[model samples]
Structure formats: C-alpha cells, structure tokens
Target chain A: MKRAELIFQSIALITLAVAFILFWNFGKGVSFAENGLPSGPTVTDSYVVLQENLNRMIPILLGSILLSVAIAFYLEEYLARTGWKYQIIARQIIILASIPSLLYGLLGLYFFVFQSKKGSFFIHALTVVLLVMPRTIQSTQMAIRSVDISIREAAFALGAKRWRVIIDHVFPHAFSVIMSGIFTVISRALAIAALIIVVYVWTKHTLQSGDTFYIPGSAIVLLLSSLLSSVLSSFLEAKTNWD
Target chain B: MQSQKTDPILHIHDLNVWYGKSQILKNLTFDVLPRQVTAFIGPSNSGKTTLVRCLNRLNDLNVNFRYTGKILYKDENLYAPQLKAAKIAQQIGMVFQKPIPFRKSIYENVAYSARLRGIKQSDQLDTIVEESLRKAQLWDEVYKHLHTSSDALSNGQQQRLCIARALAGDPEILIFDEPCEQLDAAETPKLEAIVQNLKSHYTLIFVTNKRRQAARVSDVAGFLYNGELVEFGQTEQIFTNPIDKRTENYVTGRL
Candidate 1:
C-alpha cells in the first residue's frame, strides 16, 4: 500500500474503534444521576432502534445504487452517444442534487405518504432513495465517462457489441471509480435519517426523548459502514488497476 | 499466397466521410489485396485513420459521423443495412496508434476475443492464446507469465499483445493505424517484422506517416494528400517512378 493509503486506513480504523467503544459504553440506555454518574439501567429500545434503522437503510442504499447506476449508464452510453445534450442534463442533475434534503422529504411526504398511502417504511425508504439518487447519478456518470475511450474502441474493434463492450470491458475498467462514488453515496444515505423524520412525523413514529442511544448508535453504525466501504473500494481499485 | 493475391479482399469505392458537416475524406477509392501489406501514408489529419476506421465501422460510434461509401469485403457490401459492426469487426480487426491492452492478464487479454465468440473451454482458450501470442512474435517472451497482468509488459510487448488479442478473433484482415507511432526505434523493427510475417496469413492495411517505414513494409502504397488518394500502385513504382507530382514530392521528402 502507498503511504497515504496506509495513513488513511489507520485514521479510519482509529476513528471506528473509538466510535465503537463510545457506543458500547453509553449506547445501551439512558442511565444518569445529577452528577452524571450511572444511576441504573432504564427502559430503552436500543436494539429495536438499531434493527429498525438497518432494516430501513440497507434497502434504500441498495436501491439508490442500482437505480442510479442504471440511469447513469443509459444516459452515458445510449443517450449521450445519440447526441443528447448531456452537459445540460448534467447541470440539471447538479442543481437537483444541491436542493435541500428536506424538500425531498416534503416531496416524498406529499407523494408516497399522502397520495399513495403506502406504509411508513416503504415511503421513508423510497424517499431516501430519491434524496440520494441525484448525486449518485452525477457521480456515476462521471465515473462511466472517465473510462478511456480508446479501451472502448479497442473492445469494439475486437468484434464485441456495444453491450458487450460495456458489460465485459467498460464496466470493469470503471468499476473501482463507480464503487468509490457509490461509497460516497452510501455514506450520504446512512446519514439521511434526518430526512426520514418528516415522514416519521406523519406516520406517528417519532424519536422519543428517553431513547438516548438511538442517535449515537446510528452514528457509530454510519461510521463503521463508511470505513468498510472505503476499504472495499480501495481494494477493488487496486485489484482492477491495469497500469 | 499467389491464390490469395488474385482478388482484392477489400474494395473502397468513391468513399466520402464527414463529421458534423466537416468533410474529412473525399472521393477516395482503393483496393486492398489479400495476404499483403497495403500502406496508406499521409501527413496528420489527412483522414488516413478515418479511412481505416470506416472499414470495421468504428466511425459509427461518433454521433455526427456521416459517410457515403461502398466498402466491399469479399464482394459483399460492408455498409449494408443488415451487416452489423460487430459482424464486420469479427472478420476485419484493427489496432490503434496507441497500444491498449485490456485491463486483464496477458492470457485473458488474448482470450477475451475468443471468449466473446463463446469459446468457453479452458483448454481451447489456452491453445488459441498460445497460437495468437506466437503469431504476434511474443509467445517466447510471455508464455511463462500467461496469467500475470499485461501491465508488466513493455510498450512494445503491449502492442504485440494487442496484436495477439486481435488475432485471437481469427480476423482475415487486420488494420494497423500507425502501429509504430508509439514505439521506440528498437521496438519499431520488431513490429515491422511481425507485420511482414503476418502477411502470409492475414490481409494487412498499415497506416503510417514514416515514408521509409512505408517503403520497407508495404507491398502496395497509397499517398493521401488532404483526404485525396494521390497515387496507388506497387511500392517500388510509387517510390521510384513517375506518378503524380504530389506523390513524387511526398515520397522524395519534398512535400
């Protein structure tokens, strides 16, 4: 590994270890005295909160990745190749990505929760997908575009079809860059619970005051996942390096 | 070889190519004889690359690219509405100015073309890979490191590996678009030798600006000046005898 990469891994490891320790010691229940000493164990659904967050976050993260990557591929490979105005589309995506997250929350609340009348879980998850997709699409498009055009031409000259060029050659060349972009999106998706609060409010399931472990528990989970994603993307980037 | 030379493998007739209203190649025509090296020599941006790319339809990827031409391969229309680029590419392969080995192992880089044609048996792939490498004149050096990444190879070896990759597809005709442009003096002769050796098996179209390289390698030579085919004939005649003033000037290094 390079020196910078080793340093980055070390910092990430230290941060994760500290976060884990902090969560383990104080993330069980709300127990405190006037002097801030541990009084006693209290009633807190810490495990339930953790489970609920995972159940909500995983699918949305996966959905965002799948949907955005597909959209980005179509835009770059097909539409862009057919002479579409990609710069305008990319600019529009950047504008959408920069819009406030709460606006997406409200949009989701009005559409999925109000018009469709779906369950809160589905609504919230889909809303998070909507919130994170713009940035992911932008980044994914950049990754796909960053692939060397010569490689694609070389593949085409080898009797491979357009789809084959994309699937077998282009995707592998761009996979590491794509994963790095997706990892950034994943981190964004995990921290987007604040957006879910809008739908949670309407669904009559809001964060309780005494459930103190929920916030810290979610934070540690986010940290750990981000670190894991970093490592995985780095490994993939190394594995796929051709030069 | 004499039997193969009886008929031209590729016939480009009255070809004109344009990209977004800017004409690149204008009214160009030529015949590429089978199992021989036909070199197109020209200055930069004279549409030499464009003409080569038109053979396998690689220019189709450009959205604004437009062309009016009839490219006949073995008496069949290459630009027929039903003939897909993939199908043309299978019979007519291309190597670019820069060597672009796929981001794969040396073995996989060569085998990838075969795998695309659904050659799934490992033993078959190994045999094809070895044969291609040997044909590219690279098997002796790289046979031991078949599974290693192609990144470890020198630029010359990488270019040869690309040749092996193209040959693995069993193309009858191979296009070399400035294959020696990126190679050093030491490496150029090696590639030149490979091209000379390959003429017995595959129809070769070589594009280069180096006049002597063209003189040394081509069986037939065509000079392009501003996308026009100034001359096309035997290499020795084109080099030494009377022809178009432009062709004479180009060959003698005056223009």
Candidate 2:
C-alpha cells in the first residue's frame, strides 16, 4: 500500500480502538437511577426493562436493515448509474454522513416525535434510519465502485441493459462487500439508537416525573442484538464470494 | 492482395481514441470480414486492446475516455449517438484476458446473457447453456456439475466458461483480449483450437503480443506500433514479407 494509505489506516485503527474503550467504560458504570428510574434495580429488573426496550428496538433494527439495503440498492444500482443524479446523491450522502447524530436526534424529536406523535418507538426508528442512511449509502457506493470494470463491460457487451447488468452482474459481484457495509451500518445504528433513546428519555424525564429511564435496558439489548445480528450477517455474507 | 466480395461484418473508418487529454488511437481504419479471424498484433500499450474495446463501446465505461470514430457493424453506423452500448454489445461480445465468471452456478454463468435478453424459459435456457458450453469445448468436463459454483472450475475451465457466456449471447462478432495470456503453454493450443473452430460462424478479433499465436489463428493481421497501424494485410504477408522495417523488426524480435 502507499505510505499515505498506510498512515490513514493506522490513524483510523487507533481512533476506533479508543472509541471502543470509551464505549465499554460507559457501559460498565451505567446506572438507571441517574435517568430518574426507581432505585435498587436488580439484574432481573433490568432484564424486564430490557425486554420492554427490545419491543421498541426490534422494529428499529429491522427497519434500519431493510431501509439500508433498499437505499444501498437504489444508490448503487439505480441512482449511481444515472447521470447528474449520481453526483447529487453522492454529495448529499457525504453531507449527511458529516452531520452529527445529536442533530439527527433533535430532528427526529421535532419532526417524527412531536409532529407525528407516534410515540417513542416510531420516533426512535426514524432517528435510527436517518443516522445510518448516510454511512450505509457511502459504504455501499464504495463496494459497488470496487467491482471490476471488466465485469460490467462483459455484461454490457453481451447486451445487458443498465438495470439488467446491475441486477445480474454487478449486484452478485458486489453483494458481499455491500453486505459488509450494511452490517457495519446496522451495528452503528444499534449503538446510536441506544444513545438517542437515552438522550430522549433523559430530556423527557427532566420535563416531568414518572418518565421511565430506558437507557440501561436499551443499551443491554442493543449490545446483544448488535453482536447477534452482525455474526449472522457475517456468516451469510462470508458464504458468498466478493471477487 | 485478394479482395473478397463478402461484406465486412465490422468496419472502422478514421477511428481515434483519447484518454482525457492524451490521444491514443489516430485515424485507425480497418475491416473485419464475416467468418474470419482478425488478429491485432502489437507491443505493450500500443492500443490494440483499446481498438477492440471500441467495437462494442466498452471504452465508454472509462471516465476519462473519449473517442472520435466511426465503427460500423454490418454496414450500420454503430458510433451514432442513437445506438446504445448494450445494443452494440449484443451484436459484438468481448472476452477479457482473464476469466471472470459470476459467483453463481456454472449453468447460471452460461445462462446469464441469454437471460438478460429475456430468455427466461427453463428449457430454452438449458438448450442455450448446453449448446454454448459444447461450442466452447467445455461441456464434457462440466456437464455433470452444471449447478455447482463457477469458482470450483479450474482456470482453463473458467476461461472456457467465459467463452461460453459470450457465445450464449449469440453475438455476430467476438473480441478476445489476449485470451490465452493467463493460460499455461500446454493449455494455449486448446483455446487456440476453440478460436480456430469459432471462426466459421463468429467474426473473431484477437489482440495478442504473441506473434506466433496471431499467425496461427488470424487470416488477416494488423501490426500496431505506438498506437499507429504500421502494417496490415493477410497474416502470411505480414509475417513472412512485412513491407515496413518496424513490422519486420517487430515480427523478428529485433526491436
């Protein structure tokens, strides 16, 4: 690899390791009472709270996965292949990826939570989608870009149209790489959803009493599901060939 | 020189290609007659591959690539803006230097092109897969494992499978970009024979640095030097009595 790429990769690794260490620390000293829940919470009590949070998280997880896949398919296969729209969408994804998650949480609270008034689960799900969409689109675009030009040429030369070539030739070739990106986004979405819900729960509890503290429960379930889903997705993705 | 009355399947007139600001091919004109093997012989980076890519508009895929050329297929102006790349490719298929089968079943690899053209019937697809594999001379070795993953095939089989995929499209012209470059010396002749037999129906355009391979397969040969067509004629004339000193030196390995 080039020296510049090597340096960039090293910095990225160090940053990731530091972030993981911090996140682990946050999980270790986590307390439900800080967010206004009743004190003296046991493991079983935490499990019951976690089960309630899972009910909200399950749909958010499924929605994030489905939406990410759909957005990836559109961007990689359809939008990226077209003229003008490709550049526009690409720039939009970059801008979205650069935005902070706190901003997305605020937007979700204002728009999806207050305007729609569909309760916390739906707002949290929408927030998760917004948080993950940009990275998912970007990574999937990179995956599609990494595909060999010759493969697409061969397919086109054989008379496959833009849609047909992507569906038959490009998608199968880039599926594993795109799946990896989707899994990355899924894991990110899981963590970010927990953070957003914690922030939302805290803010709502400060406004009034009887507001349930959903953090410890949401964090536990998010951790477990992120690990489980990532492992499952990786297994399915590993069975396929990327080259 | 002998001139046959058969209409050329593909005709290039004043073809020129450019990569960004740098011009590559300049005023290249040639004709590939139907049912004949035409070889493009040149040194490395001489634009032989670029020329063949223009046949099916594959060069258009490059972001910096541009060209001013008239490529005619069966007397139809293929370079016209109205003609789509996919339509042009349906008429002219390309096989790259390396075999690239999809990460799918062997049967699906052969059936892919046909399916792209809307041949969804299982029986029709089966017939096409069988016929294409037979034509590529790969049927006997892979018939039993049609449903197996294509990656399971050996290198030679994968290369032949690429040929079968091209043939499945039923293109009138088939362009091979150094098809045997990756094959071992012993395996080269097997693919050569397949190309030799393929000339009866498909107009073959092969790009190769190997002079002997060109002489062995092509009826007409074009010698390219630094993106220029130095000499072009019957393979016998170009190989035995090349008029240009560059061509002579190139053929004799003196350059």
Candidate 3:
C-alpha cells in the first residue's frame, strides 16, 4: 500500500480505539443493587402505552425521510440559480434552520395538528417533518455547491439550459453527497422524534406501537433502531460508491 | 503581415477589465480573423487568461470583477449588459488548462447539452455524441466504452473529452486557456494537432507560454506584458521581425 494510505489507516484505527475506550469506560454508568442487575420487564398498562408511542414514532420517521427528500430536491434544483429569488430562498432557509425543533413542533401543532384535529400520530409525524426539512435543505445545498463549477460551465457552453444543467450535470455529480446528507437528516430526525414524544406525551397519555409487540421501552428501542439503520445504511451506501 | 487588409471577425477595442478596485487588463485591443488560430502569449500574471475569459463574459462570474470595454463577436458587441452570459457562453465555449470532466459516462458528457436542447430520442443523441467525439478525435478510443465513467480515461483523453463536450454545443468560437500546461511533454504535440485541426471549423483563441508551440499552431499572435498588449501581428512577423523592442526581447528570451 502507499505510505499515505497506510498512515491514513493507522490514524483511523487509533481514533476508533480511542472512541471505544471512552464509550466503554466513561459513557455507560448505570448500577444495580441486590439482584446486581436492572429491574426486570414489567407487564403493566404502560407496555400498551409504549406500544402506542412506537406506532406513532414509526410514521414520524417515515414522514421525516419523505419531507427531507422533497426539501433536498427543491434546494438542489430550484433555489441554486443566480438571482434575487435564489438569495431570498437561501436566506429563508438559513432563518428556518436557525429555529429550534421544539419551535417547529409548536408551529406544526398550530398549523396541521391542531387545525386538523387528528390523532397524535399524525401531529407527531408532521412535527418531525417540519423539524427535519430545514436541515435537509441546507445539506442538499452544500452538496450541490460542492460540484465542480467547470463541469456546470462545460454543460452550459454545450447548450444546456438552467434546468438541464441541474438534472444532467449538477444532480449526478452531487448525488452521493446529497444522499449522504439525507441519511444524516433521517438519523437526526429519528432522535428528535423521541424528544418530541416526551414533550407532547402528556397530551396523548399513551404511546402507540403499530400492530406489533409492545413493551415499556419500545419508544426508546424504535428511536435507537431508526438511528442505527440510517447510520449503517449511509455507511454501506458510501462504501459502495467509494469503489 | 498580409498588408493588414483582411477584416477581422472578432475585435476587442480598448478593453479595460477590472476586479473591483484592482485593474487586471489595461486598454487591450486586438483582432482575430475568421478560420484562423490566434494565440495570446505572456508570462504568469500578465493577464493572458483574463483577456480570453473576458471574451466569453466568464470574467463576470466574480461579483467584483468588472470591465470597461466592448468585445465584438462577428461585429456584434458582447458586453451589452442585457446579453445573458449563458447565451454568450453557448456561442463561445471554453476549455480550461486542467481536464475537468463531469463525473459521468463519456456518452452522457457529450449528450448532456443535446438533451438540454430537448432532444430526447436515443438515436439522435447517439449520433450527436458520435459526431462530437469524432470531431474531437476521441471516438476510436471511447466508442466501445462510451458508457464508462469519464474520470476513468487518461488525462489526455479527459482533456479531449472536455473538448468534445465543448464541441457538442457547436459553438462558433472556441477559447482554450493553457490547455496543455498540465499534460506531459509526450502529450503536447497531440493536443497541438487537435487545436490545429479545430481551427479549420471554429475561430480558435488560445493562451500559451511555450513560444515554439505558439508558433506551431497560431496564425496570428498577440504578446501581452504587464496587463498591456505589447504587440499584435502575424505569428511569423512577431516571431521573426518584431517591431516593438519589448516584443523582440520577449521573443528572444531577453525579458
């Protein structure tokens, strides 16, 4: 292998080792007494409530992904051109991103959830969508910007109009980067959904795990699974493209 | 010098280009005739590349980069504020010193513009790609593997692919900015041949520092020094019997 490659590998391995050490020694810190373990699972009314939360969480995850993809497409294609509209759109995106996720949930509650008078599941999902949309827009914009200017110019000089340049040149060149950003937003939204549920949980009273096995920790498990899946999928996808 | 009798196809009159408060090109004036290769030669920081970019309005990409002058393409003024840079770019394509191929298949690179012009039929796109590659002298090597990624090609091939991408638009004028600077010595002459062959169909404007290579390819030559046009005339006259002292010094390596 090249010396540079070897050095990079060594650095990555060392960083991973350090991270593992920190996680094992400093991160996990729960202790148990008497039985020398945590409390065993309980069969109580809360199990059904957790199931309901899981059910509500699943749709929120899906909605976040769908919403992020839509926002990504718009930022990558429509808002990238040079004009007053581009500047205004970019500024609006920045302002939107700066708003906290809880604020977005509040806004969604006012707009979609409260007005529609639907179940908490739809409200939670819509809130998650609003929370994740701005991040996706920003990531997609960055990915599009990273495309080489020469490639875009070359396409335009050849006869490509504005839309053609984005679809044929900019989009293809930025596909991997944009997909990775989408994955990042999906993971982030999954984590945020758990927090949103905690905030709005008082109103719903019980969590809804969709037509599946229900447990007290289902909400936490669902959040963990979604986060894990997005991260793993992004890694595999990036690895496949790297070759 | 052919008695200076022929009417130039493209002319730059008193071109003064500035980047915000800093001036880059100073009162530049020159003319290029049709079906001829004109080379701009100068040392680094001499505004050779800037002058060529100004011709295509690419210099305007920088918000602060402004200019005071008129660039005439077929005697039509290009700097008319109302004219879109994209339209000007369609009329005059550019190839940079570095080979920049979009991370896509060779066929896609060639067909991108055709598709943009609303040609969706596969057969029409295939013909255009083939013709463009043939013009760029890249078809034989890339014919079978046109679907392969363009970055997989050799550096020289990638450079030719960029040229093919430029040609696919069928522009009237072509600008090359030190196109062979990144290539090895062995690849220089092949690039020169491509430039020479292209001059037959398009008005070619090139920027180069290699004196012999400039002499080998250009019909007319302009020497720029310190952001000013030092001399402009036929290639042979500028190389062999330059009138200006600065031009003579530049040609003889005395400067």
Candidate 4:
C-alpha cells in the first residue's frame, strides 16, 4: 500500500474507535442512585434495538444488491447498445448516485408512510434500499465495463452470441471486480444508513424526554460491519486485480 | 457440388472500410482459394488488419466502423442482414497478433469453443480437444497437463493453444492476423509448419508485415500498400518477378 493510504486508513480507524468509545460511555457517570449505584434512566433494551434493526437491514441489503446488479447489467449489456438513450440514462444514474440519502428517506416517508400508511419498518427498509442502489449500479457498471475487450472478442470469434459472451465470458471474468465494487458500495451505504437511523432515533428520544438516554446497539453493529466490509473490499480489489 | 470444392472459398470485391470518416482499406479485391494459404502482407497502417477483420465481420463490433464491400463466403453474401456475426465467425476463425488464452484449464480452453457449439458429452469434447491440440502441434507438450491452467504455458504454447481453441470450433476458414508476430524464432517455425499442414483441410488467410514469412508460408500472396492491393499472385511471382514497383520495393526491403 502507498504511505498516504496507510496514513488515511490509520486515521479513520482511530477516529471511529474514539467516537464509538466516547458514545458508549457518554451517560455512564452522569448521575448516582441513592444506593450509590451510578444510574441515569436507561432507555430501550439494546438487544431488542439490535434485533429490530437487523430485521430491517438484511432484507434491504440483499434486495438492493440484486436489484442494482440487474439494473446495471441491463444498462451495460443491452441498453448500452441502444445509443443515445443509454447515454442519457447513464448520466441520470450518475446524478442519482450522488444525491443525498436524506432525500431518499423523505421520498420513502412520503410514499410508503404517508400515502399507504405502512409501518415505519417498511418505509425505513425501502429508504435504505433506494439510498444504496444508485451507487451500487454505478459500481457494477464500471466493473462490467472494465472486462478486457479481447476476452469478449475471443468468445465472439468462437461463435458465442452476445448473451453467451456475457454469461459465459464477461460475468466470470468480471466477478471479483464486481464483488469488490458491491462490498465497497454496501459498506459506504451501511455507514450512511446507520448514521441516519441513529440520528433519527436520538432526536426523537431527546424530544420526548430529558433524563432518559438511548444508544441504539445497531449503531455499533453497523460501524463494525462497515469496517469489516471496507477491509474485505480493499483486499478483494488489490488481490484480484489481474492487470 | 464437387466442382465447388475447387472454387475460391472467399471472394472479396470492391471492399472499402472506414472508422468514422477516415478510410482504412480502399477498393480492395481478392480471392482466397480453398485448401491453400493466401497471405496478405503490408507495412503498419497500410490497412492490413482492417482487411483481415472484414473477413468474419469482426469490425462490426466497432460502432464507428463502416464499410462498402461484398464479402462472399461460398458464393453467399457475408454482410447479408439475415446472417449473424456469430454464425459467420463459427465458419471463420481468427487468431490475433497477440495470443490471448482465457483464464481456464488447458482442457477447458480448447473445449470452450466446442461447448459453445452445443457439444455437451464429455467424450466428444475430449476427442475434439485432443484433435485440435494435435493439429496445433501442442498435444505432445500439453497432453499430460491438460487440466492445468493455460496461464502456465509459455507465450508460444499459449499461441498454439489459441490456434487449438479456434480449431475446436471446426471453422472452414482460419484467419491468422500476424500470428507469428509475437512468437520467438524457435516458435515461428512451429507455427509456420502448423499453417502449412492446416491448408490441406482448412483454407488459410495469413496476414503479416514480415515479407519472408509470407514468402515462406503462403501459396498465393497479396501486397497491400496505402489501403490498396498493390500486387497479388503466386508467392514466387510476387517475390521474384517485376510487377508493381511497390511490391518489388517491399519484398526486396527497398521500401
């Protein structure tokens, strides 16, 4: 690794760790009980919060990855051949990818929460899916495009049709790069989604009461997950780079 | 028709090719006889590659590529809307200047082309793979390590493997676009021998910038200069006799 990347990685790790530790111990010694047991009014159970978040997140992650890959494949392999429309659509997707996650949350809130009166869980999960998909689609498209043209030519020269070239040659050759792209985008999206959720819950809790404090366990899980995922993504990108 | 067997396998007429507005090959005409090596020789940027690419319609992959040509393979229009590039490619195999082996086991590398043509039974695949490798003159070196990755092979062996891969598809016409350009001195002879041997069964179109290589391998030879066919005839005549001044200058290394 370059010295610059190493420095940046170290700094990021230290910052996240320090922030997490400070948050974990924020209200620990703020008050003392009559029995001398330090206790601030505790909020909701951490385990329940963790479980509920998992119940929402897993489905969204899987669904978003599948949906993004499909959209990306259609855009690249099929739509890309259609000329001007593909160029316009590709540019629009890039713009969508750069849009803030907060906008997606508000859109989901309007559609699923207000219009249909669905549960917050449905709206929340959908919001995260929408938030993650654009970036994932972009990354997937890049991965597919990065496949060596010669490989495709070789397959075509052997009488493989466009679909066969994609299925038999292109996909297998681009698999590791595509996987790395997926992991990297998912990691970033997970961090963003977790940040939004934590802030949202904390704001609601603070407005409702002054004494009680809550730290959602989902925050820690997501932070750890995003860390792990980012590391895995880096490893995959570096190690499997055939070039 | 038995008489058709004696006919020119490929007949290219008034072929003009361009990438965007810039012309590459201009008004090129040629006939490649069956069961013979017809070589196209020219210096770089003389439209040699473009002309060879036109044979199997491989240039269609380029969005900017356009051509005015009649390429007849077995008297049928090659550029006909009804004919798919894949189907055209099946009958016409191409080997590039650089050898590109798929990241696959040596067995799979040869078998892949067969599998694409829907040959599913393992025994049939095995036979085709063996036959192709033999024809490529690589069977002796690689037969024991057929399951190993093709990446393990040397550059020359990889080139031969590419030939085997092309052969596995059972193409009626094989196009070698500067096939020996990347091969070393030791490997070039082997490739030349394979081309010589292949001509008895498959019609061969060999393209090269190497004048002597063309002279050594080709039965009929075409000299391309500035997107035009300068001279074309039997190899000996093109090499020795005075025809086009450009052809003489090229073969004699005065160009």
Candidate DockQ values, in order, are 0.60, 0.50, 0.31, 0.58
Per-residue lDDT of model 4, residues A1-243, tens digit only: 699999998999999999867755663443324336433223233323445666778887888899988888888887634378776776566656656554564455345433474446767776777678878898889899999898888888888899988988889988998899888877776666555444444444444555432233343454455546555664565456524
Residue pairs in collision within model 2: none
Name the 10 consecutive residues with the lowest summed lDDT in model 4 chain A: A39-48
**Candidate 1 lDDT over residue span B1-255, tens digit each:** 464549888888999999888999999888888888999998898889999999998998888889897889999999888988898998899989999998889999999999888899999999999999999999999988899999999999999999999999999999999999998889999999999999989999999999999999999999998989889888989999937998888888898
User: How does each model score on lDDT?
Assistant: 0.82, 0.79, 0.75, 0.82
Evaluated on the second chain alone, the candidates' TM-scores are 0.97, 0.97, 0.95, 0.97
Better of 2 and 4 by TM-score: 4
lDDT of 3 by residue, B29-145 (tens): 888887789999988899998888887777655666787877888778888777877778877888898898877799998786666566799998889999989988899998999
The local distance difference test score of model 4 is 0.82
Best by TM-score: 1
Summing lDDT over every window of 10 consecutive residues in candidate 3 chain B, give the lowest-scoring window: B1-10
Where does model 3 sit among the CAPRI classes? acceptable
Q: What tens-digit string does per-residue lDDT give for candidate 4 at B1-255?
A: 442468788898999998978999889888888888999898999988888788888888887899887889999999999999999998899998899999899999999999888999999999999999999999999999999999999999999999999999999999999988988899999999999999889999999999999999998999999999998888989999949998999999999
TM-score, candidate number 2: 0.77
Question: Can you tell me which runs of candidate 3 are displaced by over 4 Å?
Answer: A1-126, A198-243, B1-6, B81-83, B117-124
Chain B TM-score, model 4, reads: 0.97
Give the CA lDDT, 0 to 100, for residue B78 in model 4: 96
Question: Number of clashes in model 4?
Answer: 0
The residue pairs found clashing in candidate 4 are none
Give the Å error, residue A240, model 2: 33
The true-versus-predicted C-alpha distance at residue A151 of model 4, in Å, is 1.1
- Lowest lDDT sum, 10 consecutive residues, model 2 chain A, at A40-49
